[model samples]
Target chain A: MADNVIIEAPMPGVFYRRPDPEEPVFAEEGDDVDAGDKVALIGVMKSFHDVTVDTDGVVTEFLVDNESEVEAGDALLTVAPS
Target chain B: MFEKVLIANRGEIAIRIIQACRELGVTPVAIYSDTDENAKHVRLADEAYNVGGSVARKSYLDGETIIDTAERADAGAIHPGYGFLAENADFARAVEESECTWVGPPSDIMEQFGEKTQARNLMAETGVPIVPGTTDSIESADAVREFGDEHGFPVAIKAAGGGGGRGMRVVERDDDIDSEFEEARQEAEAYFSNPDVYVERFLDDPKHIEVQVLADEHGNVRHLGERDCSTQRRQQKLIEETPSPALDDEQRAALCETARQGVAEAGYVNAGTVEFLYQDGEYYFIEVNARIQVEHTVSEAVTGIDIVKWQLRIAAGEELDFDQSAVEPRDAAIEFRINAEDPSEGFEPMPGTIESYRPPRGIGIRVDDGVDEGDDIAPFYDSMFGKFVVTGQTREEAIERSKRALDETTIEGVPTTIPFHQQVLGDEQFRRAEHSTTYVEEQLDLE
Candidate 1:
């Protein structure tokens, strides 16, 4: 059985999966990510901040859609630890 | 007239715009964030759409999303009330490019006024008495010293792209100019994305007065008198009143005429304000607010001219039907900005759900608010939830009426600026119109 960990937004802002429209998404469901790996970006107050994964895991599901508004501590994605 | 107009803002200003739209027989479409999904502005609008997140960046400041929402709602025009994107030249251009009417001044004109030095140059060229300051950015401490030598010491180093008391520093002595100048430049870059700084002669006890002006596409401009907004804390206005007790008839006329001439020369259209700093008996031009202001209600009360309605009319290609003489201002009106702040605790924001909210009512009182009973005053936005405007035939009557109205108002669950306002109304210096911009912090005993 895999241990599920929820990735939460650190601040309130628009959650963007990709850094830019022309760029690929930072991380995707079913993709393996290491601790401290960038998963998404939160844009607020005319600037962008990176959201990173906390542990080495496979992204199980993205709880928030791309470019969706998010609040601090809201569950953004689910990850299953390796 | 537009079939539907989108108000790209939230709170009392949004509701204010909706009221204007309804009066003009135009449908009002409101945009809200996740936190403001059930806001009063959303409920009052003819139609409401969710823009994005709870924070302003993802929602209110997201120009692309707001324009897209306007398109989706079939809104022919957009009114950005006060804050957010109200003065954004890029947003105005975007709205224009998107084939929707931008209900403010021309974007190009806004661009010019957005830069402080350029605005000063323009005002000077228009025969308006501007504060003795650099018409361009100062590059070194030498230039600051030269300005000080020319205009005397106590110089103010300000950001060329900033306003509302941000990116400003006062150097009392020539020795402090170098560091203060560098600090001002850095603050300008951080706040306005412009590192340019300019020097000005700092006036120590100046009355903060501003004149409201309205213009249309045609060659018509009118001044709607002036408002004294000296009652402020850290440059944030707390109380404002019209028929500035600081100015006599001659001074008032000169101030208003100078403002109209300056704005007209800039080819500015729609509703705007020309702020000035008055010291001794002379008034010097400061900056132009290129959009409808929070204190427009005070001007509206005295002038009896609906500024929001005119913003819509001007954007719809309507001309100013009335001449300058037609704008007859009467009575004394005061506007108290009621923010959810704890005055005892250094005016820190105290955002919380309103358990019981009851605004003052009856004659001589009008309350423009965004929250209701049980509504949460979200931490994601500005602390101000409402404005209580009181009007009377005289300044004395207006002050007395405001006191009664403030007394009747009731709110629970969060600390408010009500107690502070009550104290201000009772203060002798405030009643005598002797308070300046620094009075709130320097003189007032908050305890």
Candidate 2:
């Protein structure tokens, strides 16, 4: 069985699953991603900050919903290593 | 007046509008996000409805849902208490096209002023002294250079639809103009979804003064004295006071009257603010905040007029019964914005649980806030949680009372801008009222 890693939010803000409101999401569960691949955004204080994954893995689950309020260190997604 | 008014906003301003609605014998209805179900505004309103998710986009900024909620609640009017969708022309038009009344200026007026270039041109034609800048949007870096050459170095490239320093960049040198101009355009595109920009001569040091005006649909307009908002950080106002210490009696009258004339010529209605940049002896028109502002408390304190009530009355087709001579503002008042920010860490946003919350009391103190004790400061919205207003017969007395008011107000858990406000009250330049817009960001040292 492959071990999974959790990606946490660096700061508290509104979690965004896509680049723009009318655009497609960056990635969904069961999608493969590599290190430095943008996965989410934290919208705070009229500024948007990108959240990137650090390791190559497949996103298995999303813990936070899009446009939901999030706190720092909250788990956003679970990625299983190949 | 409306029998039921729906406040399409959250926090302090929403509460303010709710109180105004009650005063007019109207029922106040509130809409809240998932996080604000038990919020103070919700608890105070006559009726509360769930808008959507906690984040503002899914809730507060959703125009379609807001209209639907207003319709379902049987609200006769919708009052957008600043921020969110207050200045959105499209939203205003949708509301106007709906059965409910929009408690603001006409949507056409909002659209005319939304574009900065057109607003400046209108001001010029209306005999308002506009700042020396382009009245048209520039298409390339060459135009910026041309404007800079015609004017001087250190020109400001600003977005046509942006305000509050959102998409503004100042270029100092000849070589840096291109990059700075490009950055301004990109920010303009990203923030406002408009890439058009224009150039203007940046004032090195100037006082930020604004005049409040109230207008009715019947062409009755009146001016409430001036507020000097010189103490700011990164173009964000922290402390605002009425009856500007920088202006004498004659200058105040002229500025106030000019503001009234400018808006009156524009055929504006409802409560709005006319902003200006006052330098040596000249005051230049900047732009208009088409809705009630955060610092409106200072003006209300000095003028003893409920501006919000007038907003409701005007939307109902009421006329101003008093003449210009009958309106007179007395005394001096000050307002300090209390924001959930860590001043020690470059004023970074600190969102957490507020363990304790208390505001001062007595003769001359007023505090407007959205949160109570033990409430959480969510990071999804603006950091400001409240406003502290104090008034006195004289400016000196006002400053003295401000110190006591600041000391009495207490809050724990999340760090606030209280310490910064306290330091400002004690600073010599600030006390003397000699500070300008850039004074706080460039001169004040916070440790």
> How many clashes would you count in candidate 1?
0
Cα RMSD (Å) per model?
A: 5.7, 3.9
Predicted candidate 1 versus true structure: per-residue lDDT over B232-349, tens digit per residue:
9877899999999999999999899999999998899999999999998888988999999999999999888999999999999999888888888999999999898889988877
Question: Which prediction has the highest TM-score against the true structure?
Answer: 2
Tens digits of lDDT, candidate 2, B102-196: 99999999998877768878878989898778868998898988888887777889898787777889887656767877888899999999999
- Output the worst ten-in-a-row residue range by lDDT, candidate 2 chain A: A42-51
Docking quality (DockQ) of candidate 1: 0.09
Candidate 1 positional error at B346, Å: 0.9
Candidate 2 segments exceeding 4 Å error? A45-49, B134-199
- The candidates' DockQ values read 0.09, 0.58
